[model samples]
Target chain A: MSALLEVRDLTVRLRVGGSDREVITGTTLEIAEGEAMGLVGESGSGKSMTAKAIARLLPAGAGVEGSVHFAGTDVLALSGADLRRHRAKVAVVFQDPRAHINPVRRIEDFMTESLRTLEDVPRAQARTRAADALEEVGIDDPARRLRQFPHELSGGMLQRVMIATALLSRPLLLLADECTTALDVTTQAEVMAILDDLRRDRGLSMLFITHDLELAGAVCDRTSVMYAGQVVETSAADRLHADPLHPYSAALVQARPDVTSTAERLVAIPGRPVSAFEAPSGCRFAPRCPHALDSCRSTEQVLTGLDAGRVRCERAATLRGRLLDPTESPTESEETADA
Target chain B: MPDADGPVLSVSGLRKVFGTQVAVDDMSFDLAPGRSLAIVGESGSGKTTVARMVVGLERPTAGTIVACGRDRSRPARNAGERTRRGREVQIVFQDPYSSLDPRQSGAAAVDEVLRVHHDHDAATRRRIVGELADLVGLDSRQMSALPRALSGGQRQRVAIARALATEPKVLILDESVAALDVSIQAQVLNVLADIRDERGISYVLISHDLAVVRQLTEDVLVMQRGVVVERGRTTDVLDEPQHPYTQRLRASVPGPGWKPTRTLRRPA
Candidate 1:
């Protein structure tokens, strides 16, 4: 029962001359084999930074303080010859479809390169492999798609290609970072199914990073609520949705609008995610947290209780409101409370 | 709710074509004064194009744009009646990052329109700018900040403040809240709702997110590939969608607790 990927105390920093901007601090989470972990956060909440750190794909100036261990190997400690092979074990699916793919390159060309770059397969065989990989991602006509450019395909089709490329690598872990946000809802659901099937069939481990709490609630086995770069709440998937421990987590749940029920007003988590470059004192969410006490301003809470999802705030346990479970039909009490 | 009295704007057989592709086809709707009409559709559904046509940024290939009972002079081909329409109607776009000029401060962005539309003195313009900012919930202190300097929510408020500066009768928003998170979106929407209630300004909101549309608007219009296939009361349309396209669109949107049901096709 060993985890496929174990990230420990990971920190990412952008160094310019002497000054360094701490982008992500104290993010530690793991994805067990065939298990899914939902990494939930707002934009610039360091979810993306934590994802990038896993592959050691940091930009040149990015300095890391912690280890990203994938399958017992400290990926961060590996150098040149070892690190190159280590890099192929983990792949990332970025947020933007526009920037992720090369606009000029054919979808097949990119897919083939992902496979051939690691093992030096014959050009002819790679083409067939690429077509198979494309088909695996729900693209019916892979042969025709090989000739088309990125712009030629719709955003949904392009995102499928992105998943296809990640599958070709046959990585142990996939970092799907807001991959479905840009897609239309029907198409977004289709893409999510593909990922779900891939995880089940391929035994893939995923760190699904997104701002959408609803998507996380539906898919992940476990969820880590990261606010301003720290893991505030870690709970079993059902438990997290049923009863979110953190105040931010509660606010996120309360903020989510129920599609089935009609609402007069959707309560939004007030204020914005703090900018990573300018870290805040006290709780990063304290400025916006409705339950903030005098202690929150002076004390920073470290994540407690690994068994059940834990939060850092002194009032984390005291703030015990439950999140409405999506699985069960809304009860009268739940509806009345939310209403 | 249809009134016995006439609507503020009535559109019938509104069709706009770019070559053979129909951007807007046979669109018909009526908006009463102070009422909000939300047009929800995915990208390329012609929501933006429809908004552009409504604001006189683009002339329709055919149909009548009866505004306040008179057909607007077919959007003068060269001049682009965006400014003339500014006195009565104004458009707010999706990205506040790109919607407002990067260099212009929030105060200047709002006042620039006033300076162009009305030959007002500096003090009058400044006072008007402050009033506009206050209406949209921006404090006087935030007046000097540029678009880049402000957060997405603040910048959107700045955009709304600028749009309100002209004292427009109608506000046509093209996915204006799409760029913001739920919280920030709520904040901006409050400002918009306040505007409609206070000034009796008509709103034509074009968005892909149905929840926002359903929550804010009394009426809803569903568009697919530039043609509106369904139109009704927001709750009615959402509760029991008539058209398949509307059903599918409604299903796709993540509502109060909808988690996209495994990306939404029921695994077909």
Candidate 2:
């Protein structure tokens, strides 16, 4: 089957205060119908920007190149009523519900506003549909909840309300950008379970964005790791930890503290993460990668297919088995060094 | 300094009530010198309340907190006493952004702490500030940069350095690494471990992440609604939890091959 959402060689540049910075460069990925794709990255990795690009939510004066296609429609080329229709087809749930939602509005007003204004549904019909959507997300006493203000609900409840409102449009692609990052673990589990059930039951597609690799691994079918505004690796989510292709991916797998076991010291990646503007000339991760060769510093690497997966590292084949080994040092890989 | 052989920090029957509601009740723990203890719980579980009570931010209605062989159960009687108490215990908060002043550079923040707590000369204060920054793996560029110019991890390092400037015997990490990314979290955790090994300082860690708790602390306490449900060695308690709440919490964490199951209701 053809992919539902396709982004090809997409590059985004932000112009703020007379300065330009490339936030995303050459990002490419596809989401099949009903497939949940995980976009995993640290801060400044541009995972959120890619979602915004697809949703047409980029800040004013931001320059966009390449193409974002959804169901054979050019998202970047959409305008006027067509853009509004396209937006209705895609919904975004942010990290914080309180910030996105209006504090003074009652739950019913907020939930039904989209349906009432955009689709011109009757107020009574919109309220009924909103109640049903709330019920579907596991909220009890939906009628009572609809009358309550935003502050009356807890964080988890507010998040559920946001999800319910997002579903009122019946969007095909859901952009969940760190939706659970601010929640408690148990609450996060509940929200995640609700989303998982909703997606599976409705056959909806999702672009799940999170910094937690383990979370993405558990929830998504395929995962794409981003670094410094580029896609570094793409593979089946379950295989990411066991068999990571890029050195950066391997380092990320090793950097986390394991709950089941204890290591003498966590294998922390040296140097802090950089934004795309500050990324080096060649490979973005070479500054911190332990297995980085001299060639990696000067030669630009491109994403290539390997073992039914894709990676952006040229030395992926040579460094295959040793990537996860904690004791593998930078100098230890000198056998492959040209100098 | 107090007796080196005894616990660096001790609490007994800690209780706090806001009007009619009891936020924390009958909570007690001790931090042995050169050791770390974690208080793990979900939101409103009173873990943060326990930290606040220990740090003198909240006055306990009942129970006593003894730090460095002195009763700190009540707020300090004078400014001098408060400064002295600060030297005994310090805390690092969750958000690095708000905890730091936007206008002050990292080195200035550390220097300000040193000036308030100690009688060091200008040269000595500068030297100590540089030493503290280096101890947290912050370079000179980060040291001179303001909080906004630095990353979240860099800001947190500056916060850690400021906390260490007081040379406190016990440090309370109140969800210190929760706001950071995974890579940066690992870096900060390593810095904390190195500090513990080098200075032999005790730690009272308040957190909800089990993986972080397991990595940093030796002992763990599982709390629910201000009550201690389970407490034991970190590995043993996490590996084989006896309390239903603790079991549910462990099951909630997502890991390799882990799946989130819907509970019957939201736990009270």
Candidate 3:
């Protein structure tokens, strides 16, 4: 099946301190129709930058290269009416609802502003649609909620409103950038369920960007691990969780504290995450990878097709079955038996 | 009756009222020396309020706090008393970005704490600062860098270093690693474990993440709307939660092979 959104060789450069620095270097990704693709990375990995680039939301003094094709149209080449039309089909929900939603405006105004101004819908009809959207997100008494301001509602309720507003545009693709990160676990679960249900009901495609690997694996059909502004690995979610090929991916999976496992120590990556400017000439993750070789640090690696998906590590083929299984570490089972 | 050698910290019927709203209500717990206890709850659940009360940031309307075998329910009346309390218990806040002064370097921040708490000479202060930095894995270069120059994790390390300057008996971590990246969080968690091992300091960890609570804490207290809904060993409470709220919280954590489900109805 053809992809609903395809980003190819995308590079984003920002003018920082009078010099242009590459923030996202040759990152390519694709999301098939009705599929949820997770982009997992640490800070400065360019996951959010890549999503913003695809959405044409980069700030001033930012330069872009490569093409983003959506529904057989080049998103980069669009302008004026075409750009507006493209934006309508692709909506983004940010991490913090309080930051994105205008505090002074009523819920109805925030929800239906785009529809009324862009689509030229009547205010009365827009209000009706707004109420329906709120109800769809599981908020009861939609009419009462529409009359209230942003601060009148709780964080979880406001996030629901934000998701409801995004759905009002009827976008085929949604970009959720840590939409649930600021919420409590129970609220996060509720929001994820709502998003998942919405995607299944509407056949929506999503690009979920977060620092949470386990959350990504739970909600996304496929997962991509990014390091220093590059896609290091991509695979089916279950396979990626079971056996990650790239060393960085494996380390990330091991680094997390599991709820079920009783491992004595979490395996933390040795060094901090590197930015694009600080990235090495060869593999970006080589400096911190435990299994790195002399040759791995000298030559740049390209993404190679594997059994389930693609990986950028040169030794991924040989590293298979040697990497640590995130959930089934022997120490955990032994500790469990002791308990 | 409290055991003579039972716990390093103990609280009985702690309550805090902010105007008409009760931020923390009838909360009680105990922390044995070198033991870690996690208070897990959502926002407005009074977990933070309880932490604040323990650290003396907020005076409780009711209940008593006994730390190091001294009563701390009433506000300290003098600077000496406050200093004594500071040396007994210290808290690390959530936001690392705002916890430290923007103008002060990491080394300077730790030095200030040393200067205030200790009457050591300048040479001794400098050496202690370096040792504290090394304990939290901060390099010499990062020691002189300002907060803005450091990453979230590095800033948190500085915060941890500063908190340890007094060598307090009990360290209150209020969502300490929540602001950090996953990898950085793991590194900090490891550092926390090392500190507990070497110094034998008890911990009062306040967090909303169940996975993190499981990683670092030995016991768990589940709070809901300022009430203690559940309390037990971390593994037991997490594995077989008795309270509905606790069960919901344990089930909400997303993991491999887990599927998102609707929110459970709150038990009345």
Best by DockQ: 2
In order of DockQ, best first, we have 2, 3, 1
TM-score of each: 0.91, 0.97, 0.95
Tens-place lDDT per residue, model 1, B1-268, is: 2343677678888888898888888888888888899998888888888788777878888887766655763864444354555667788899989888889899988888897777899999988887788788888777788777789889989988888877776788988988887567767777777788888888999988776787678899999988898989988998899999888777766433444444322223
lDDT of 1 at A270: 70
* Highest lDDT against the true fold, candidate: 2
| Interface RMSD for candidate 2 relative to the native interface | 2.7
- Assess candidate 1 and give its lDDT: 0.79
Instruction: Name the regions of candidate 1 deviating beyond 4 angstroms.
Output: A16-18, A322-339, B1-4, B77-83, B119-123, B254-268
Question: In candidate 1, how many clashes are counted?
Answer: 11
- Give the DockQ-based CAPRI class for model 1: acceptable
Each model's lDDT comes to 0.79, 0.91, 0.90
RMSD of each: 4.6, 2.0, 4.4
Candidate 3 structure, TM-score to reference: 0.95
Summarize candidate 2's per-residue lDDT along A222-333 as a digit string, tens digits.
Answer: 9999999999999999888788988888888989998888778998988887788889988989989877777899998898998878899988988776788656665756
Predicted complex 3: CAPRI docking category = medium
How would you encode candidate 3's per-residue C-alpha lDDT over B100-214 as one tens digit per residue? 9999999999999888898999999999999999899999899999999999999999999999999899999999989888889999999999999999999999999888999
Estimate, for each residue in B26-80, the C-alpha lDDT of model 2 and write its tens digit: 9888889999999999999999999998999999999999999899998898998
